[model samples]
Target: MTDRLTIRRPDDWHLHLRDGEMLKAVLPETTRHFARAIIMPNLVPPVVTAADAADYRDRIMWAKPKNSDFKPLMTLYLTEDTEVRDVRAAAEIGLIHALKLYPAGATTNSQSGVRDFKKVTRVLETMAQIGLPLCVHGEVTNPEVDIFDREAAFIERVLDPIRREIPELRVVMEHITTKDGVDYVAGGGDTIAGTITVHHLVINRNHILAGGIRPHYYCLPVAKREEHRIALRAAATSGDPTFFLGTDSAPHTDAAKLQPCGCAGCFTAPNGLSILAQVFEEDGALDRLEGFVSEYGPRFYRLPLNDGTVTLEKGPPVEYPAQIETGDGPVTVFDPGMPLYWRVVD
Candidate 1:
C-alpha cells in the first residue's frame, strides 16, 4: 500500500473568511495547507466596491497568521448597483479576482445581492471583455422552488441565459452540490468550471435529516442525495480540468448554528485535506488527488500553480479538534463520522 504522497500545494477556489475575530481563528486552518484561497465577499455590508475589496483584503492580511504565505484572492459582491467602470478598475489593479453573484436573499448576508440582472448588463459585458470570471452562488431564491431543486432550476432559468448572452464570460459555479451541476460543467467549454466542497463529497442530505437535523452538517446549497455524492466523487477523481476543490469552509459560532434559524455553512477548513485524502484513497484515485486540488483550480482562474509541496503520510487514524475557539465563540469543525488515516505531514 502507498504510505506517502506529495504534490503541489492546493488553492481553494472558493472560501469564506469573515471579518475580525472569526477571520483570525479560521484563516490559519486554510493557510496551513492551501497557498491561496479565493475569499468570499458575503460580509454583512458585502465587498461591493473595489475600495471595499481592498480594505477587506488588508484586514485578511493583518488577521492572517504571521509569516504565512496565504494569499487572499479578493472578489466583489455583485449587486444591482455594481458599476462597469468599477469592475474594470478592480480587475486592472488586481484588487479583485472575480465578481460573486448571489441571488437576492440566497444565503448569509446576501440581501444585497443582485435582484435586477438587467442592471448589471454593462458590468457583465465589461467582465467578458476583460476576462474577469464570475463566481456564482448558483441558486434561485423564489419561494416556490423547492430548496433541493433550486440549483437545477437556476441553471435552466438563469445561468443558461447569461451564458447565451455573453459566451466569452468565464463563470465558476461555486460549491456545486448536484448531479445537474456536474453534468452542466462537464458538457461546457473552457469558459466554465465548477467547484465541489469537501463536505458535500462526504455527506449527503441523510446525514443531516436522517439523524434528527445535525446543525453542523447544515449549509447553503445543502448536500444532495447519495447519487449526487457519487457523481461529485466521480468528477473530482476523474482528473477533468472542469472540476476542482473549493471548500466553502464557512465558520459560524456553535451558538449561531444551533439557533432557531441557523446560519448556512460548514467549517471544513481544518480537516478538509485530510478528508479529501481519505475520499480519493477509498475511490482508488490517489493519483488524481493533486490534479483536483492543486492543478485544476489555478488553471480555471488562469493563475500560476503554487510551487510549494505538501506531503500526506498514511498511518494510524488521526484526530482533529472538535471545535476551534475564537473571540466570538466556539466554531464546530466538520465531523467526517469516520476515521481519517491519511494526514498531511508537512
Candidate 2:
C-alpha cells in the first residue's frame, strides 16, 4: 500500500473566509494545507467592486498566519449594478480572479445577488471578451422549485441558456451536487468546468435529514441522494480536468447552526484535506487526488502552480477538533463520519 504521498500544494477553487474574527480563525486551517484559494465574496454587504475586493483581500492578508504565503484569489459579487470597466480593470491588474453569481436569495448573504440576468448581459459580454471566468453558485431560488432539484433545474432554466448565449464565457459551476451536474460539466466542453466539495462527496441528504436532522451536515446546495453522492465521487476521482476541488468550507457558529432556521454551510476547512485523502484512498484513486485538489484548479484559472508541497502520511486514525473556537463563537467542524488515517505531516 502507498502509505505516504507528497504533491503540489492544493488550491481551493471555492472558499469562504468570513471577515474579522471568523476570517482569522479559519484562514490558517486552509493555508496550512492549501497554497491559495479563490475566496468567496458573500459577505454581509458583499464584495461588489474592484475596490471592495482589494479591501477584502487586504483584510484576509492581515488575518493570515505569520510567514504563510497563502494567496487569496479575490472575486466580486455580481449584481445588476456591477460595472464592466471595474471588472475589466480588476482582471487586467490581476486583482480579482472571477466574479460570482448568486441568484437572489439563493444562500446566506446573497440578498444583493442578481435578480435579473438581463441587467448583467453587458458585464457578461465584457467578461467573455476579457477571458474572466464566472464562478456560479448553480442553484435557482424560485420558491416553487424543490430544494433537491434546484441544481438540475438551474442547468436547464438558467445556466444552459446563458452558456448558449455566450459560449465563449468561461464558467466554473461551484459546489455542484448532483449527477445531472456531473454529466453537464463533463460534456460542456472547454469553456466550462465544475467544483465538487469534500462534504458533498461524503454525505447525502440522508446524512442530514435521516436520524433526526443533523444540522451540522446541513449546507446550501444541500446534499442530494446517495446516487448523486456516488456520481460526485466518481467525477472527482475520475482524474477529469473538467472537475476539481472547491471545499465551500463556510463556517457558522454552533449557535447559529442549532437554531430553528439554521444557516446552510459545513465548516470543513479544518479537516478538508484529511477527509479528501481518506475519500480518494478508499475509492482506489489515490493517484488522482493531487490533480483534483491541486493542479486542475490552477490550470482552469490560468494561474501558476505552487512551488511548495504538502505530504500526507497514512497511519493510525488522525484526530481533528470537532469544533474550532473563534472570537465570535465555537464553530462545528465537518465530520466525515469515518476515521481518517491519512494526515498531512508537513
- Model 2, residue 250: distance off in Å is 0.4
Residues 280-321 of candidate 1: C-alpha lDDT, one tens digit per residue = 999999999999999999988989999999999999999999
Q: Any runs in candidate 2 off by more than 4 Å, and if so which?
A: none
What is the TM-score of each predicted model, taking all chains together? Answer: 0.99, 0.99
Q: Residues 165-252, candidate 2, lDDT per residue (tens digit)? A: 9999999999999999999999999999999999999999999988799999999999999999999999999999999999999999
- Where is model 1 more than 4 Å wrong at Cα? none
**Candidate 1 pairs with clashing backbones:** none
Report every candidate's CA lDDT: 0.94, 0.95
Cα deviation at 131, candidate 1, in Å, is 0.4
lDDT of 2 at 241: 93
Candidate 1's C-alpha lDDT?
Answer: 0.94
